[model samples]
Target: MATTPPVIQAKITSDPVKLPLAPLLVSVVVGVVVATAGVGGMICYLLRSGKVPIRVAGVAPVVPTAPLKTHMVALEPLLVNLADPSGSAFLRAGITLSIEDPAEDKGKETNAGEAKPSSKDADAALRDTALTVLGQQTSDQLLAANGKERLKAELKSALAEHNPTVKVADLFFTEFLVQR
Candidate 1:
């Protein structure tokens, strides 16, 4: 005789089943998001705590300068000889200069209380300049029609050097004499 196979039974339960891992997984994800948000907040707070300073440049100064002082005096006369290839000639020289000081010129002190000159400063200065220039003068230079003018320039420069305190601005000729 063949024995019959045992019968299997199927049953359905009405009670709810608990999923243990689902809540733990959700908590871990939320924790990670919270930690990231906390770190971002900390970084923002640190940045806001630091200080940044600003700087600027560009400034100008304001001031004025004083003008120079000058004076002029008439020259006596200058006689120069020409150094020409053909022959010798004569030149008359005259000039005026803008001296820094009028006192350098020879004259009576206009001030009523001023004393007379103890030393011949003016005469000496003039003579010195004249001789220096006359010694170096040439016939060609003196023979020209404008010889007086050229002499005046040299005289002015020389006189000015002699009278450093006095500036020789210009030269003039009141009397001229030239003989060939």
Candidate 2:
């Protein structure tokens, strides 16, 4: 028996094989197809839902309101003596208010169906109500830069209760004096 073995029969090649491009092309095609499908689905969903505009509660625009007519009414000065003996001083103050819808008396006689409200009536009511409120409020309440603001709001609320149609726009302290 020969121990050397048989001669080689296969051929030897050294050339490099080219890799297939099909895998990269398939990946690109799949990505494009998925992206298009996702976009188309989103658009179809939006259109099928009817697309009604959203409404936010308490965010509606307020319609313009009618302008109220204003009239200024002047009041007599009020004097107040402090209750405390140590800080006993008298304060004198006059108040004027810009009132809206003052009750007025037209000379023209109305038919049996008359007796509607007048500007003068509204003005008089506002003046009386304002004077009462100011009288009750102390000088500190009426005189303080910030406290005066509170007094104004209180006055408006007070007036509104008595006269619904009449509105108090502003309070003008024409004169404020103190004496010992």
Candidate 3:
């Protein structure tokens, strides 16, 4: 007896399933916009609440006020004998002083008979004070590494004591010589 092939059946559809592109794209764009807005809002909130610190680049901090104006007064050079043994050492120094202008200090009150000190008198006093301080230094002391700085401090202190009216802001040694 001859047997025929078993019968097989299958179903097929001719129509393809379709997806709408416009709605899909719109949904994706909306999602992205919402996410960006949320992140931006969070950052703004943090900054406003002081929870995050921000530093700007290439910007200097603001200064509160302008600095006081000062004038420089150059004194005549001084030559003095050093306080060294054998009387063999001497010093020659040129000094300049940075003094705050009295005109800028309007807060000070002067007496009726007390005339403001003249610049000439102040200059004379400064020269005298400087000579006195310079004559006390020895060649060895002035030749050290920090000698000039020490001398400046001494001169400043002496100037303040000798003349309270003159506000010495700083001192500069234009010329210095220590001969042994």
Candidate 4:
């Protein structure tokens, strides 16, 4: 006798399962509102805490700067004959002096107001010192690549001999002409 095969059972539904649209939309809207509120709160906190730099109308920010050490002053041009063996070379140079700020000086003051000479007095004193220094330089010395720097250092040293309070910062030759 042949055995009959076991019958298979099957269940079928006509309607499809669907997710509720209202709940999904409500959740999305709640998430967006929460995110927006969080961003707005952060912005408000930053503004209130003064962490953000805000420039107001006609208001400038106070920035810290290093104290100025040196200042520049223009000096009258000097015409001097160079100390050459042939004595034919001469130099005409317009020198600008970079002087140290006396206000920033920490040295002890002895004479105070009376001892501190005016810039005009200092310049007048510097004129003779400059002429002496230039007159001592040879044509080759003034014409070299490092001539100007050497001259500046020499002049600073010479000027210091005359006036210790008048510190020389630098020297610039605006017009340099050598005549032989």
Which candidate number would show the highest lDDT if scored against the true structure?
3
What are the root-mean-square deviations of the candidates from the true structure over C-alphas? Answer: 18.9, 9.9, 10.1, 10.9
lDDT of 3 at 126: 93
lDDT of 2 by residue, 1-180 (tens): 769877989887998888789998999999999999999988888777857445668887989975655546676676666433546666676777776544463334445554344467666776677666755655555456786668668877998888787667877777777554
Clashes of each: 18, 9, 0, 0
Error of 1 at 35 (Å): 82
lDDT of 3: 0.89
Q: Candidate 3's residue-wise lDDT over 66-112, tens digit each?
A: 56556678888899999999698999899989887677455565565
The stretch of ten residues in a row with the least summed lDDT in candidate 2 is 101-110
Q: In model 2, which runs have C-alpha deviations exceeding 4 angstroms?
A: 1-62, 82-87, 102-128, 139-145, 161-166, 178-180
Per-residue lDDT of model 4, residues 1-180, tens digit only: 999999988878789899999999999999999999999999999988999867779878899986555666777899999999999999998988777766745343344334333467777888888998999999998889999888888988898898797778777889899998
Candidate 4 similarity to native, TM-score: 0.53
Q: Model 1, range 1-180, lDDT digits (tens) per residue?
A: 899998887688888997799899999999999999999988777767664333445755656763333444455676666454444666565545444434444342356454333236775687667767765766656667887678777877777777675455555566666556
Per-model lDDT: 0.63, 0.68, 0.89, 0.83
Q: What is the TM-score of each candidate against the true structure?
A: 0.40, 0.43, 0.60, 0.53
Number of backbone clashes in candidate 1: 18
